[model samples]
Target: MKSEPVAGVRPEVKRRAEQGSQQLQGEVQKLELENLLRTKFPFDAIEPVPKGEFGGDVLHRVVGAGGQSGGTILWEFNRTKNWSDAWLAKLRDDQRTAKAEIAVIVSQSLPKDVETFEMVEGVWVTHPRAALPVAMIFRLSLLEVALARQSTEGQQTKTEMVYQYLTGPRFRQRVEAIVEAFSTMQEDLDKERKAIMKQWAKREEQIERVMGATVGMYGDLQGIAGKPLQEIEGLSLQALDAPVVNNRSAAE
Candidate 1:
């Protein structure tokens, strides 16, 4: 049996398929770079620019300790395209608009003599392998320069005031002074409490003696009033045996 003739693939279909494959590969590369940046610099902030925003793939903002913003770096990625001068111009524009200190292009293609990163027309161009290192260098250098400027301009004096106060020896001395004052106050309070308690005891003893005398006077008055001796004895016994009010229960 004769086999049917096979049809050749159309040129347009092949071209579209190739383009789609390249697009997919580019996306994968972008994601890998993004993840690497995020993992390498956990403290820094990394954001992907939306399409038609800055013509940049990612934006990285360096963050100092205590959540202070340090500097900005703008990044662009190229997979299959050749390096072009127009890209540098676009990067410069984007850097200005983003207020970024550094602009970098990570590409798979590089000039014949270029091995890693090189400054070309004020924009940094690097291979994929060197992208992270280049980015880190720019970020740290810019951050250090910014900090130095701030220090020289006295912009950081207010920020450092609290830190100095909390960490200085004067703070420790003040704390010790407070502790000593509190101890003295507590000792005085204890002495005053004891003195009040002693005075209360003395008053209670005097009251008891007065109560006994009053009972004795009542018995004498009954005798003078000419009551019977049996009734007088009973009244005197009752007066002397009267129950005292409990001050503690009343206070409670």
Candidate 2:
């Protein structure tokens, strides 16, 4: 059963996010995030929760052709000056209330350890700009799970196992691996794109000069070389653990 939202935010009781100092900024960020998700990911349905809504700032439902269910994601946006551990517990309760499989908090201020994005205590924390890319990986996971469920529609045993795995710690570990891999790639791409754009006026022309001419071939070169070729250098990539310094040739 759905709970009817109570209206009004009590400034005295709930600060920071509820009719508090940064409420206005938080609200704007929430709306902007909603718009970004909708524009980038057409497959999912993004619903902005009313001001007094209990669960989260936004509800993201994964929808496919013929109304296929791919689970849901609960998003909470914050533009506060400091990070709060309280949000995690609050969102966990909200996640249960909304029956969302994933809970994500997009904020400018994150935990000391987390720089860009990371899963902390089963909740996803990310910077606002990186939110879209992080969300793309999440949506893909949901879709993959949906497809698996579809294939095992009649097999109750397999379905049960799948459900178990999803709720299990191993699932979280696997998802973390997926997120880390994607995060590394995303970081590398941004760093490389900027470096390449600066070095060559016509990037396509430069790619042809290097080994393998076509775009696909250029991509293969990147995959094989891991980092940008020596022709492109003077760029620093903070390796997350400890981002490596600018090297002449980051090539394998």
Candidate 3:
């Protein structure tokens, strides 16, 4: 016979197991949402708050080009329960602690009125499927506002430069002129390379001509030396043969 589970032990174990599973799911959701936000807004600063922190799950700070913080967005993740007013209140309190300009909840279960995202008591509620777009909208808005404030605070020169480079005809004309100069320089380099190659060919022809003339002169000298040597040998032989009779006749 199979033994039955203990009276309170089984229920407690089941409750703990369920609680652990929910916690795991919630953590996973938080990580996924954080990764999505980070990828979508790489220029912004993303910070994941520690567990039991006074603020929300993630904090996004709008960072300017100069590495200054502008606006903050507090993000919360809820997977176990449906969207409720209590969560909104909690987000509001967390926002104050986080010093955030916007508060959002990325939940698995959205409220009845919210198909994707809607403002519920000033807190933005978004489902997981629409998290990226919703977060992007908030991040871009905050960035625009931050940049505007920065521009008013004597940081307009760089912004003006970017604008002019993007839209000014003079900047385009300067770029075109630089490109044309580079093209002309490349063409001149090609022409110089061709001229050098031609010079090398002419030098090679002159070298070949000189080598041919040297070889011909050497052959002519060899021929002239051979003829004189042959003539000397012939005279020596003829004198050897007739010399004995001549000497005797002279003496007589």
Q: What are the TM-scores, per candidate, against the unseen true structure?
A: 0.56, 0.55, 0.55
Inter-residue clash pairs, candidate 2: 238-243, 239-243
In the predicted model 1, the residue pairs found to clash are: none
Whole-model lDDT per candidate? 0.79, 0.79, 0.77
Q: What does candidate 1's lDDT look like per residue over 87-127, in tens digits?
A: 87677767766767678889898755788989886678999
Which is better, 1 or 2, measured by TM-score?
1
- State which candidate, 1 or 3, has the greater lDDT: 1
- Give the C-alpha miss distance for residue 50 in model 1, angstroms: 2.6
How many steric overlaps are in each model, in order?
0, 2, 0
Q: Report the C-alpha lDDT of model 3 over 83-178, residue by residue, as the tens digit.
A: 566787677767766767788898888878788899887689988899888877887787787677666776568877688556743354345446
**lDDT, model 1, position 115:** 85
Regions of candidate 1 where Cα sits further than 4 Å from its true position: 1-8, 155-252
Segments in model 3 whose C-alpha atoms lie over 4 Å from true places: 7-12, 51-53, 65-68, 154-252
Instruction: List the RMSD of every prediction in angstroms.
Output: 25.8, 24.3, 26.7
Instruction: Enumerate residue pairs that collide in model 3.
Output: none
lDDT score, candidate 2, position 116? 99
Q: In model 2, where is the ten-residue run with the lowest total lDDT?
A: 231-240
lDDT value for model 3: 0.77
